[model samples]
Target chain A: MSNWRQMMPTTEAYLLDKVLYELHHKPDDLAAYNEDKAAYLARFRLTPELAEKISSNDVAGLYEAGVNPYLLRAHCIGMRIPEDVSLAALRSLMKEGDDKWLN
Target chain B: MAELTGIYTASHTPVMLNFPDRIPTELRTEIFGAYEAMGRDFEAGRPDALVVLSNDHLHNFFLDNFPALCIGVGESYESPIEHWLKAKRRVFTGDQAFGAYLLQEALKADFDPAFSMEMVLDHGSLTPLELAGLDPDLPIVPILFNCVQPPMPTMRRCYQFGKFLGEAIRRYDGAERVAILATGGISHDIATPRMGMVNREFDERLLQLMEAGDSEAVVAYATNQVHTAGNGAEEIRMWMAAMGAAAGLPFKRAYYRAVSDWYTGIGIGHFGENSLATVGSIDG
Candidate 1:
């Protein structure tokens, strides 16, 4: 909650990091992301369930699997996802835990 | 001895550039106009180097390891990352000698900080340069604080850091006319549900203190209290740091606006001795 902790070791943790990094520095290729998705994802040793989550681009599901939402959102910022989409997706699963502390 | 010629704080959120039309023209003029004013007057000071205080948006650092504070000590730097900003890649001269001098002096002052010779200038630093039409060739010393990732340096700690930084600059025997530019936050968040929310009241409350040179009061806000405004609003650590470096001198308002389009309250202010121009006036 203070500084980010180690990303939990899970398929989503391993695969989502790649998803976000690719989306961040090379977002133009998401369309191509699917064509070779298996080949790219194969390297992660992910189970079929986690591969599905990564390939589906389920941010909420990934978060449930311990992928940090903040890091996930960096992908949103880089990919230029619409604000409403990101808000609806993220809010469905997270409360922004620290909001009540506001003065 | 090196002299701090100017001190400034500005919003570096990139949405303002990407969606300028999202904001009403009147607000745009008011906010950017203030940036224009600051740019003109800041350049008038002809600072040999501008040290920009900002935070990385996970652009260069990650969860594996993040320094609470970092300074670029390279001979030159480039803002090459293209995903968040549309700026063309261009080389910028870095005042490494001065950066190293400040680093040594800061350590001597008891503030432990990390130093880097390689890094990219993200929107947190570059957007202000673009907004103000600042000269890229104007040698820069980029200083970054871990304002985004939380568990960051306390607001008071950041101010103290700047205070010590100012002392270091003054202690250096170099001849550079230095300026300090702190970027980001006047109450706005991004990538969170609160994205697009601007706490005008919160921004103004802090601005009032800044204008009055109340560094202690500014730092009194608990970190969570500041986050109440917005997540990215945490970048106010930059403003607090600038206030400290300014040595408690009152700053003149450059501009203040609650531009929801950028989802940032977007405030600008400047501090200078004798050269404190009137609000909204571009001192020639």
Candidate 2:
């Protein structure tokens, strides 16, 4: 099992911080952030299609297309993404996948 | 003794009630129609008091000292947040006598329940009130259970309490007709890594067990069965208690929908319209 704490560089802050960092800075001179992002993505083996879906904020499409549950959860809790993502899209995703939430 | 004239159970669908985009327009219409049918029953029964069993969503009760079982005996109850919910603001009076009796009986039965005078109702209780078309001035005895937070009651204990509550309600005396309502559950997960999962098959089976008055089976399954049936299923114990209150009554499934997008197995059932003449008493 992947140590979720080890997948990311900084474990001190909440998940929202990681998302905000990715949104603000695509890459940095320091290799630490890049290694962290790469490690995080590698832990789930997120496909390009899944990344695109997350970027598009199409929650229904993600679930309908059978997106990985781990990645989906990470995105939903803003653990790996910023909160500025469209609330409308998030709400739609929630509605589409309501049945599966507690299950 | 005040008879439990009716029973209603509701849960947060976690979706726009009538939004076409969220639920297909046709399905939405059908769901609303079912709500209307439930309303018709409430209108016919005209219950003098509604005993609502619901869980607080961290809105009113925080993590600390949040009672596992709480009875609200305030003169009036109000929901702190109403903007997000379409429900109208309404004040409900409490039945202190009945409330006190329930507390005492639950304790005597070995369940250490709590009492609150300044409790505020949240969407869990308010959603059903809106669906039932109940007047704001209607009297209600709110029973808040610890389902959302940790240290929840065990399935066996919940069912046991249900049996106890059945006796408590029958012991109360009043002219007003009483209605027992339990809100929450039909398979939806929230606030965790597994958010937005719904288990339709489990929901259907639970309804079946409830209709059969098989509390033993329900308790056993809740303890040993797959968690998908009830990741947050502890809340459904409220419904079990309400069902116990109306044991021996045949219930009709007014509505059942597995709207995955809404992340809920929306179900509404009713009793009292076709109740058995005699119900066997539950011994502590």
Candidate 3:
């Protein structure tokens, strides 16, 4: 169970991005999305490097470290990044947009 | 003839205590006195119910598409989670009849307002209730707007809604003297780098405009000058609506204080054509 949960999206950025993506495209399947996201995070183990990057406040680096930029931005700003920022930041930094997350 | 009774507008002072040094003794007395007077009126006949307009601060709604205007028609309401506010009481009842009437009137006027039966009152509502000395039992119709968050309503829309609200209250068949209260915003920022900024000059000017019953100017200023005043200045729209409801009536500036520490310009004033002198002192 611990290993499976570790593989899931544990970071706040990943959770937020998952929530946003689910809200926009597959809104009807939010329960499934949340459950799946939680499970995925539980399975995806947090690497020490990623943990250190977040703790060190390397916002951009943490995004590059396989942490969802959308989620990282939310954690950094202390609020959900506005939809515009979420879309733009994902595109410019991660080469990922709303569609990428939904898929 | 319908009796146009007391009209109250309050700024939600975030501070825990009524600091004497920050709020001058004279001003506190005057403001408290006005509230006492209003409280007395409520006890005497009380309006059929109070029509209150306040802003919601991310408690009921988030960044995802909050309505510009929403009303509570619930029979009972609770205060939101604010351990700091230290509200002395919990649970307030809503006047269903008045709420329904106001909703119908607002809709007739082309204002599409959302309704909630189970809603929580934030500091925006709690602070005004505290300052006004209102009994917890006072039946109220709560109207919440997205003032704190972005994608806010236009000043013109708020003013127009206030006008419609006044008409709605008058149209109600109930004989109870109706009082309208608008709470929140006298210049303070809660979000972003400029948090804790309070604009005394802007607040004073706003009070002056409200006293004059200059809705047009108030709306225009809200559109153009609110950002300069403070991000929280949008809460002033609630006051504009209350003023609209009491148009053509004499409004008294009962109390005014710019508490720099609290980052708020707190003021309590009343509107009623037949109310006493423009200024009076309350000794407590």
Candidate 4:
């Protein structure tokens, strides 16, 4: 009910949320984590391009593809992107005033 | 039975970590002095358990399973946040006994609050406590609210939740004295393009209502109305919870400063004793 736009429920958004949450909180077993990640991604209609963008910590790309900066910033951090590096990308994304800005 | 000894609200942000850079030295000294003053008061009250009401920074949960309100029942909590500030980090001890009782009572009251045995403490729960010099060994129950992202609960609902929580604390059979600490924003925009902006007018008005003990006026704040100030202003949900827990109690504004450089209002206050508020003093 606030001025902020509602969260996106797309596969990309779901994938990003899980990816961030898992990166910060992963299973102790490596094989189990890989298997779990596969099963989780399988549930979504994720394209290879979207997956690639996330893997690369491409925050600007994520933003352009409908991922809001709030979630994107978390993703960047979980992926271990340097603070200055990720924060710079986030700032650019917010200031872009591009069509991607849902607000 | 355990009794509510002190109820407090303070600001918690990265701004508090890098104080000299964010706030001027003159104001910073005074602001920290207030926290020390409040800390002295808290210790003198001899509280045993402190219930911290704060917001998570999307580090604990995400849009997939964002909890509106959550109670931590774990025996201990760690802060994985603050890598940026490198703020003094500590593993705060949790009060599972009191937390479990609070959870059960809230559920019985028809308020479904999520309970966690493993919850991470972020700056929201730690910043103010460390700055205020709260005894680290004191048992803590961290109650997190959804202040970021959309679909935040209304102040009315949060107040109701707080009322139930207060009742449960009062009903618990223990000799322990409990203190309620609500930590977050008065008015600051952390996410939006206006990231460093602080609304002094909104901060002042809210403080006035608290000093006059007008919780009804405080609860009347709808989500969208507060959005006009800033997204971070949403964290005032914590303050509303404090008011609800201390409803009808007289209060005093401990300190207030609109630190634009820090992107925080730096508002702190306390609720104590019962006193009838003059009706329109709140609305005006």
Candidate 5:
């Protein structure tokens, strides 16, 4: 099984996915996240490391920590994070057998 | 007796509705034309209702409450839930009785699909229909498969469900004609590192298998190797279900093109004896 599936059921992963989902869908949450990143994230019971990852726009770290890639990508778009940054982060996770279709 | 008019499948991407100009004008025209062609075939079936099998894009359900399979029994459905989606906000007429019938039949068959009376549909259901230019007044039933999240129904399970649904549709006396449509995926990545890459080889091979009416081969290949295609390609499970509904009728490809700009391998085809007799492959 993939890491995305393994880490999905944990409280931390759930919190991370929930916050990202809100940041993308809820206007008030997005405004709050933009106005005060720490204050907004404080609403959730996220771990310090998970909060830091969300706070720092750590796409790869969040993904490795089990944020659904689709949700992570949508959140990045909502946050106005450049495509290249997330692309580079995603690229770092690819292995030899991954993305063989691209070749 | 109600007839299973036809089983159709297509790939859904927001870019097709959101950013059509990203691709060349000619390619865009052809893609739209292909959809229109499918629409014509759908109309020819004279279906009393359309049953769309698509997945929710986290618009309706979140991680907190997600079901592996859900059926919408609402009297009407508000679709294109995304405000950012470049499509009109409209309500689709729903066949509440028909949807309820399917739900009851599914339960009798031991397939416990969650049911909702007020499920808002996202682009997954709206895009293909809107592009196909289907009639707004025509009633529809939406069956949502959880392709986005993990632990989704396997390809074989979806196949079995489709087969069961097909028999149920034929047995229903409420509707004289019902058309089935399954949307999503040939091979394209989304939001990941290989975001813009489209897998032509995977798309063509899968289409070939479908064209040959090899449901077993399609299910086997899609289940075992879908991971290599892309995260989005998991939606091919819907295609497997469509195959099951086809009941081994050979598919005729209406159009197929690998559009990386759309971040999806756009392919459209229908299963049955009435569709285009020859396969059409258009690479963009």
Candidate 6:
């Protein structure tokens, strides 16, 4: 059981995926979110902590919290974060042995 | 009586369609050629309907409620829901009767798969179909498994379901010629640190096992070493299902390339008598 392998998604992670899923599918919701981030996130009832993480583009933190990397990437895209920026954030969090899948 | 026309598996990466220029022109041509070849063979199957085994990419289902296995019984499905995918948006004709039959059979077989009358397919289903240039009019019975989220159906479970699916297809009195298209993976991580890394070693081994008709080894190897391959490799569960449906039939590889830029190890192949055989010719 590798540390990085997908585990059961936590409630916060699930909620994050929900928010991202909607934004990915619904352009209007995304536009609204981009316009008023707090008001948009408020509808989901996301905690201030989780909201802060997302608002700050905390890819590594979200990934560590078990947010599905796929959805997390989509979230970054929804946030208009560049692929390189998100990848760098994720890579910075990588541990020494996390590269086993790369072998 | 309805009979299995052909059994096939393919990698359904959106990049091949969305970012074909990411890879060199020669590789793109080769990959496209492979898909076209498979399409030609698949068309020759003359299947009245196709059973597509793929996973929803968080497009149709969300974490709030995700089913381990879901069958679409809709009269039709609109695909490439991303809207940004390079493929055109089109309505995929659905074989509702066949899908309903499969759902009933699945329930009777002790597999409680969820049923949907309204389902939209993401890249997982559309990419391969479009790349192959298959007829748009060809109706389909799409079976979506939870390959995206964890706690997904195990490789063995997928294979068993596939076997049951094969039995159900044989018992079908509705359509005479049916085909199965399982689209998913051979190794490459997605949205992770090793995102673009391709695990050719893992891909080749699995493909070889499938070609040799060693379902036991395939299931065992995939079950154990899938973590080493990549998270996206979980999509191999679909391939296991295809192997299950074509149990005892050896597979033939149509194409394989470890295109890192494509962000996945792409592989295509089919099982049974004639890898390229048309309808009524394949061993049911």
Q: Summarize candidate 2's per-residue lDDT along A15-94 as a digit string, tens digits.
A: 33233234322344124434565444443334665544545555555544533222333344333333224334434544
Which of the numbered candidates is closest to the native, going by highest lDDT? 5
lDDT per residue, candidate 3, B97-206, as tens digits? 67877787788888999987778787678766766578788788999876754556777878788878887777677645777788877666442223334566677777
Q: Which candidate would rank higher by TM-score, 3 or 6? A: 6
Task: Give lDDT per model, in order.
Answer: 0.73, 0.59, 0.61, 0.71, 0.83, 0.83
lDDT of 1 by residue, B1-284 (tens): 77888899888777766667876787677777778778888888888888999888776776567899998898988885546556666777898988898888788888889999988777788878877888989888899998765457888889899888887877777656888899988777665545566677677778776666666777886354575687678788888788888896777777777766677777788877644454542211
Model 5 chain A TM-score equals 0.86
lDDT of 1 by residue, A69-102 (tens): 4456666655566766766775574356644432
Whole-structure CA lDDT of model 6: 0.83
Q: What is the C-alpha DockQ of each candidate? A: 0.28, 0.08, 0.04, 0.18, 0.44, 0.49
| Candidate 4 wrong stretches, greater than 4 Å | A7-10, A19-103, B18-20, B80-82, B222-224, B274-284
Per-residue lDDT of A20-95 in model 6, one digit per residue for the tens? 7887788698788879889888989788998888777788888877788768766775566776787777778666
TM-score of each: 0.85, 0.69, 0.69, 0.80, 0.93, 0.93
In TM-score terms, candidate 4 sits at: 0.80
Worst 10 residues of 4 chain B by lDDT: B275-284
Candidate 6 global Cα RMSD: 4.1
lDDT of 2 by residue, B236-255 (tens): 77776766666656665667
User: Model 4 lDDT vs. the true structure?
Assistant: 0.71
Cα shift from native, residue A41, model 6 (Å): 1.3
Clashing pairs in 1: none
Chain A TM-score values for every predicted structure, listed in order: 0.60, 0.29, 0.33, 0.55, 0.86, 0.85
CA error at residue A6 for candidate 4, angstroms: 2.1
DockQ of candidate model 2: 0.08
**lDDT (10s digit) by residue, model 5, range B201-221:** 888888888877778898998
> What is the Å distance of residue B98 in model 2 from its true position?
2.6
